[model samples]
Target: MNVDSPVFLFDQGIPGFENLRQFIFLEIEGNIPMRLMKSLEDQHISLLVVSPFFIYPEYEWELSEPVKQELLIKTEADVEVWSIVTLPAEPSQATLNLLAPLVLNRNEKVGKQLILHDSTYSSRAPLIRA
Candidate 1:
């Protein structure tokens, strides 16, 4: 990949798409908070992910030891967090998978989808707040 298209390596890949490991983020224009995470291994697989902080500033979670080591994350600055977004028929009905946030080690270009078992957050949290 070129400098403009740096790819993220998901060591174990995302949960359902385990076989596809490499991905690149395609930014969406026009003040959008979402991004298109396109798989390098498969052209057909693409996921819409959003920074949870943008939608919920209070959103927070701790990474397990295994996850931390796997990503080689050293500090908060070393990582970027994103949540999978699910768009429905209606724009307002879009939801984000808050229960499982995708964390990427920026310095290492490594990523992993982490499922929070102790959290109260839902897998499908509403995108638009009332």
Candidate 2:
């Protein structure tokens, strides 16, 4: 199984998170709810992720043109989206930012993290209780 996959960012010549071109998504089991995102290039940088729907329901996402072209996403039918969250100092206080999401075209294992330009979202939106 692919345990540690490299995630990329758009930068230089990359269209979607080309700067963060490679990352590994690690899942921590035997725990209530915990996950780790370890960066392959810079091991020190990692973001905690969780199901955003837990807090925000009916979240909608849209991809950018450059990202679609860079990732080569053929159609809206080809993508799965996820959001990154901050592991708050306190587990209960942790929040998930649904406005911004990390998109993945699972067919090719290509993914990118993007922040929506509109200010209609919050970085620390709380995930609804499950």
Candidate 3:
């Protein structure tokens, strides 16, 4: 997992994470295996992540051309994605942060957290990110 000093956190350590300047990109350990992406801000910690196959089982992004270009991802193999989990006051109220998601281009080790302007989405949208 240390490809050219891979910046991924799953199989790597977050050296100097307390002072890390790159807030946009990261490496995280999803519920399953270690994926890629971590939160430097308050949105999330513990590096929550999800496999596209599990969470977004029915996801088909209508991403704009600009976003696709920004990710520098010309193909499906380059995409890596994740969402945040919200600990509920009680088990019945559990939720996930689906309004904003972290999308990354593993090929380049670059990432970005985007807020879905779509009002249909819930800030505490389920991890289903559906």
**Model 2: per-residue Cα lDDT over 50-89, one tens digit each:** 7565446666666778889877799888776666776656
Question: Candidate 1 or 3, higher lDDT?
Answer: 1
Total clashes in model 2, counting residue pairs 3 or more apart in sequence or in different chains = 18
Candidate 1 on 55-125: residue-level lDDT in tens? 89998877888888989988989989999999999989999999999999989999999889989999999
Give me candidate 3's TM-score against the actual structure. Answer: 0.60
Q: TM-scores across all candidates?
A: 0.93, 0.70, 0.60
Where does candidate 2 have its weakest 10-residue lDDT segment? 8-17
Q: On residues 52-86, what C-alpha lDDT tens digit does candidate 3 reach at each position?
A: 44655665456667877977879888877666556
Among these predicted structures, which one has the highest TM-score?
Answer: 1
Error of 1 at 4 (Å): 2.1
Question: Cα lDDT for residue 79, model 2?
Answer: 77
Candidates ranked, most accurate by lDDT first: 1, 2, 3
- Give the alpha-carbon lDDT of every model: 0.90, 0.63, 0.54
* Candidates arranged by TM-score, highest first: 1, 2, 3
Candidate 3: Cα lDDT at 92: 54
* Model 3, residue pairs in steric clash: 9-27
Every model: Cα RMSD to truth: 1.6, 4.1, 6.9
